[model samples]
Target: MRVTEVVLSVGIGMLFAIGTFLVLRRDLVRVIFGVIVLSQATNVYLITMGGIQGVAPVVGGHGGHGETAVTDPLVQALVLTAVVIGLATTAFALVLAYRVYEEHGTIDLDRLQGVER
Candidate 1:
């Protein structure tokens, strides 16, 4: 594992953590940006996982060194599915947020919905 790759992996992981934290924000705009960040982080993680050095797995060539570095296609597929799902989810969330804004003129959760005593 190269130092650059390690740094990139850590960076992507940090992005995911940051995005997750942003998603927990009460402001709707921050939440929307958080979702986008989360999606990007996931995509970056998938790409990083695919960066291993090895021949294509389909070749089935038995090299003497027997190094087991193969591209992780599964992660790629999972990331692809997740991106699509995230898009749909984001669209729905945006629509809901818009409705809230139309009805209440604000997207702040605490401001829009008062605490019930």
Candidate 2:
């Protein structure tokens, strides 16, 4: 594999690891952040899967005629859609966290568990 792919693979792994760590924490906010990180990692992985050594998938764009490679536009579109969905999900999660904090007076999952509903 190329050096760039190797580097990106390592970075993706690191992000996954960090996100997992945050997700296992007791803090509700940290869990939300972890979910966001995981989503971003997924987007990056999708883009990397589309390959990085090609021109944009535009019609009659730069590069030779029918000789140069074009990056996968489908992957780009999927990532864009994921980004918008992720934003909405994040906002919803934050609102839920806020409501939990308002009702329970704490954002810690452990503390929340002890409180009666």
- Candidate 1, backbone clash total: 0
What TM-score would every model get versus the actual structure? 0.71, 0.90
Residues 31-94 of candidate 2: C-alpha lDDT, one tens digit per residue: 9999999999999999999887877677675657567788888989999999999999999999
Per-candidate clash tally? 0, 0
Which portions of model 1 miss their true places by more than 4 Å? 46-51, 56-68, 115-117
Number of clashing residue pairs, candidate 2: 0
- Candidate with best TM-score: 2
Clash list (residue pairs), candidate 2? none
lDDT of 2 at 67: 71
lDDT by residue for model 1 over 39-95, one digit each (tens)?
889788777767656656666565647677777677777888888998898889899
In candidate 2, position 102 carries an lDDT of: 94
Best by lDDT: 2
**Global local distance difference test of model 2:** 0.91
